[model samples]
Target: MSPTTLPDGATLRTARPGDEPGILHLIHALAVYEREPDAVENTTDALTRSLFGPDPQVFTHIVERGGEIVGIAMWFVTYSTWTGRHGIWLEDLFVDEAQRGRGYGRALIAALAALCVERDYSRLEWTVLDWNAPSIAFYRSLGAIPMDEWTTQRLTGTELETLAATADGGGRDV
Candidate 1:
C-alpha cells in the first residue's frame, strides 16, 4: 500500500472497511499503552461490526506513516443537556510508541476539533486516566480544561441489563 503523506509524512484519513485489522491492532496498542493489556476483550469481529455494521454508531480516523497504520482516533457524538447541543466524545486516541514523538496526536485531536467546529458541535470531550501526566499535558496544551466539578458514572455488565429491565415503574426483574 502506498503511504499517504501528511505534511510531516503522517497521514490522517477516515478508516475504510479494509482497515478492520489495522484498527484492531491500534486498539490493542492503546490497551497496552493504558496499562490494561489484558482488558481488551473486544474482538476484531466486534470492532468490524460496530464500526461498519448496517447502523454504524462510531467513526474512526487512522493515522498512517510509511504506508502503515500507526495510530487511531475513534469518536462518537453525544448530547450534552447543559449545552443543549451535540458534542464529540472521543472514545479512544492512540499512537504507536515509535510514532509518539511525531505530531500524530495533535493531528488527530485537531481533526476532531475541526470537525466539531465545522459541524457546530457545542463541545469536544474525552477522558484521560488521572495518572497519565503526558496525556494530561497534551490536552492542556490544546486548551482543554478538566471538568473537575463533575464525576463520571457508568453502569455496565449485568448492572446495565438489570437497570434496563426495570427502568419503567420497577418491573418484575427489579
Candidate 2:
C-alpha cells in the first residue's frame, strides 16, 4: 500500500526493516500505558524475526513524524470458520502521549480497516481493557461495538508448558 499523509504531516505506512527499534519502543510504551510496564519481554531481534522473517506471520503499520515513530498498529491475520475467510486481529495500537488528539490513532485503525476491506476480510477486531474509559469512548465514536458475550482466555508460562506436556503428540514429532 502507498504511504498516507496525515493532516498533521505525519506519514503512515507499513513497517520495514530497521523499524524494529521504533516499533519495540512503542510496544514498551503501550505496556506502560496498560499498567504492565514489566510485562513486555519483546526485543528488537524478536520483532525482526517475527515481522521480517522469511515466513512472516505478523505485520505492523507505523506513523512517523519528523523522522521519529509516533504511533503504531501491529496486527495479524485470523481465520473464521463461520465466514470462511481471514480477518485482522489488531494486537496493539498506540500513539505517543504527546501526539494524542492529532488523529494518529484513528488513522492507524482506519488503515487496518482499509486493509480488511481490500482483502475481503471478515472483520477488524481488538480488545480494550475495561478500565480504559478514554479508549473505549474513542472506539465507540468510531462505531465499534462490544463483544459482550465473549470472554478472552489464555494459558501461559508453566500452565502452557504443562498443557503441551499432556498432549499425546499423536505419534508425530512435537
Candidate 3:
C-alpha cells in the first residue's frame, strides 16, 4: 500500500522487516507511557520473530515525520460470531510523548479504521486503561463507546496451561 498522510503531514504505512527496531523502540516508549516500563517482555529478536515470521499473527502501521517514526499501531484480527465477520483488535496505539497532540494518535486510529472498512471487517476495537483519562477522552471523542455490558477476560502463563490441561482428560503432562 502507498503512504497515507496524517493531519500533521506525517506519513503512515505498513511496517516492513527493517522497521522492527523502530517498532520495538515505540513499544518500549508505549510501556513507559502506560506507567509500566518494566512490563515490556519482548526483545527485538522476539518482535522480529512474531511480527515478521512466516505466520505473523499481528500487524502494525508506523507513522513517521521528518525521517523518524513517531507513532505506531499494533493489532490483530478477530472474528465476531454474531456479525459473522472479522474485526480488528488493536493491541497497541502509541505516539511518542514529544509528538502528542499533533494528531498522530488520531491519525493512527483513523488509518486502522479505514483498513477495517477496506477489508470488510466488522469493526475496530480496543481497551483503554480506566485511569488513562486522556486516552479515554480521546477515544470517546472519536465516537468509540465503551462496552459497558461486557468484561474482558484473559489467562496467561501457567494459569493458561493449567486450564488447557483440564481438557486433556485429566492429564497434567502438558
Candidate 4:
C-alpha cells in the first residue's frame, strides 16, 4: 500500500524490501535508547529474511519526513484464547532522537491502531519498561493501562531448547 500522510506531514507505510537498513538503524538506536546498545545481536540480513522472506513472520511500518525515515514500528499478530481473536503485538516503536517530540511516535501508533480498527483486531498492545517514565507517561496519556497483574515470562536460548527436548520424554511434567 502507498504511504499515508499524517497530520504532521510525515508519511507512514508498510516497509518495502529496501527498508532493512533503515529498520536496523532504528532497532540499534532503540537499543541505545533502552540502555542496551550492546545487547543488539540482530543483523540486517537476518532482519531482511525475517521481514521480507517468502514466509515473513513479522511486519514493519515506517514513517518518513522530508524523505528521511524518522520512525518505525515492527509488530506481529497474536491470538488470544480468551478473546478468540487476534491482536496486534507491537514489538517495537521508536522515533529517531532528532525526530522525537514531533509526534512521530504517536503517528506510528495511530497507524497501527487504524489497522486494528480496520481488521477487527481485538486489541493493540505492547510492553514498556518500568524505568521508562517518559514512555509510560506517553502511553498513559493515550489511555493505555498498565498490565500490572500480569507478569511476562520468556524462554529463549538454551532454556527453550531444553524445553523442546523434553517432548522426547513423553512431554510429561516431572
| TM-score for all models, in order of appearance | 0.90, 0.96, 0.92, 0.94
Cα lDDT tens digits, model 1, 39-155, are 888787888888889998998988988778898999999998988889899999999889897888888888888889988999999999999999999999989999988889999
lDDT of 4: 0.90
Score each candidate by Cα lDDT. Answer: 0.86, 0.95, 0.90, 0.90
Write the residue-wise lDDT of candidate 4 on 63-172 in tens digits.
Answer: 98887777999999988899899899999999998988988888889888888988888999999999999999999998899999998899999999989988778587
Residue pairs with backbone overlap in model 1: none
Error of 1 at 18 (Å): 1.4
List where candidate 3 sits over 4 angstroms from the true fold. Answer: 171-174
User: Quick one: best TM-score, which candidate?
Assistant: 2
Shift in Å, residue 133, candidate 1 = 0.4
Worst 10 residues of 3 by lDDT: 165-174
Q: Model 3: per-residue lDDT, tens digit, 28-105?
A: 998988899999888888888888999999988899889888899999999999999999999999999998989888
Preferred candidate (lDDT higher): 2 or 4:
2
Error in Å for residue 5 of model 2: 1.0
- Model 2 lDDT tens row, 1-174: 799999878999999999999999999999999999999999999999999999999999999999999999999999999999999999999999999999999999999999999999999999999999999999999999999999999999999987788688634555
If both were scored by TM-score, which would come out higher, candidate 1 or candidate 4? 4
Q: Determine which window of 10 residues in candidate 1 has minimal summed lDDT.
A: 1-10
Model 3 error, position 18 (Å): 1.1
lDDT of 1: 0.86
Give the per-residue Cα lDDT of candidate 1 at 4. Answer: 43
